[model samples]
Target: MRKLALIILVAVTSQTTWADAVSDLKNYLSSTQSLQANFKQTVTSQQGKIQNSSGTLSIQRPGLFRWIYQKPFEQLIIADGKQVWLYDPDLKQATVKAMGKALESSPAALLAGNNQFERNYTLRPLPSREGIDWLEATPKQADQSFNSVKLGFSQGQLMQMELHDNFGQTTRIYFSALKINPKIDASQFRFTPPKDADVIRE
Candidate 1:
């Protein structure tokens, strides 16, 4: 029947599109070594309160990243491969922990680490929207913090990420002005506590 044939055609086309999106994401991740971008993040609580923050992010492969939140407040999170530091300027406090322990359930770990995506997550493509190709990644670990993560790419550049956590909180981050494989100084990943700040090592 003509109608049955049309339905099959549509299903095949959808599957092909999904496959292409996943392949495109894998290729982009494999080719990128360093990246810098400006980001806007919105976190919505379970009760529906929304908070917005803007920041700049720089990341290097093999687990190094710097996230600086500059709007509404100033907070810095840096991972120097072996150690991770979180500094709250207003509170004059810094917390340090081993990177492996701190990033176990973090989205940053997925993006910045050298882990194989297929091994750690089940990836599927979402319908394209607003000129962006979207992919959904569900972590293999049942105990992970987030329920699911979605990544969006525009012309092979990572442009957005959305995460749904177990506690019913959702965080969406939009990336703009992305620079791929940029020349980043290694010193950018290092953090030093302010002289007057209290440092707590976890």
Candidate 2:
């Protein structure tokens, strides 16, 4: 689940003038200040085992986002600019960490928070596949967990994402019902552990 959160957080990349797809994506990110979407995720392990989950996510620029897992279990990951809180309702536990410590190398962080995403990644426009404009981002730093990430867009909206990890596992995410620049409540980015939950602060 941390992988899922990490994948969504690390969104940095470098770009070239290869195609409109690349420019369109950069434009969309720059213009979009907030968004909400439903997502379906599939993780395929190196051994070929697959796990599926569904969730809803909301993001506001400059270090604020909420990701809620609603299928297969219920969990919440909320980052309120200063700190990140991970709460697992089933386990009755919540973990908290400083945002800088938690998202040091997050790709999604660049995607959602940092407007200057073209900083630490090599971005290439991939051949359109599945009728979706695709862009690939590979981190310049080799010490990261994932090898590369791919983003699929259509009609100026993000439709999908794929992350290939160093361990040979792949995580694919499809987004739907996307609301770009939607009004999201600021409270959603804040989290409070349940009364009975064990709280761990890091």
Candidate 3:
């Protein structure tokens, strides 16, 4: 009947739309070798307190990233493929850890590393919002630090990410002036402790 045909058409259209979103995400992840973006991060605590931070983010594929927080406070988190370093200028201290261990439960790692997405996450298309194609990713491991992550893309560019932590805190990051596949110097991911600073290795 006409009603049955219409139902089938709607179902097919929905499926195609979902597939397109997933495909777009996969292609973006596979093609992006390096990226730079300015970001604003908002964190809401379980008790409803809110905090805001603005930062610049840079990432090179295969386990390299630098997150520089410049406003409110200055902090640097750098992963150099082999090790991860956390530098706090105010404290004059740095902590170093093996990269694998540092990325174990990190959502940032998911964004920066060349991870096998399908192997680690179940990806599904979220209803489009604000003219952005949204994808929701749930970790295969039940012990993940965050409950789930949502990624939003506009015109094939990553624009936003939302992470919900196990502790009920939610962090939302909005990206602006994003540059994909930009040339990044090798030294960008490297970190050296400053003179007279405390360095702790784990």
Best candidate per lDDT, number? 1
Candidate 1, position 127, lDDT = 81
Residue 114 in candidate 3, Cα distance off native in Å: 1.7
| lDDT (Cα, tens digit) per residue for candidate 2, span 134-169 | 888888778889999888888778889999999999
Give a tens-digit lDDT track for model 1, residues 85-201.
999999999999997744644677667977566767888768878877888888888888899999887777788999999999999999998888999999999999989999999
Residue lDDT tens for model 3, 1-202: 9999999987886676677677778777788889999999999999999999999989998789999999889999999988989999999999999977436445665678665777777888777788777888888788778899998877777889999999999999999998889999999999999998999999
Question: CA shift at 198, candidate 2, in angstroms?
Answer: 1.5
> Between the candidate structures 1 and 2, which one is better when assessed by lDDT?
1
Q: Global lDDT for candidate 3?
A: 0.85
Where is model 3 poorest over a 10-residue stretch in terms of lDDT?
A: 101-110
Pairs with backbone N, CA or C atoms under 3 Å apart (clashes), candidate 3: none
Off by over 4 Å in 1: 1-6, 101-105
Report clash pairs, candidate 2: 8-108, 9-107, 9-108, 9-109, 10-106, 10-107, 10-108, 11-107, 11-108, 14-121
Which model is ahead, 2 or 3, in terms of TM-score?
3
Cα lDDT of candidate 2 equals: 0.82
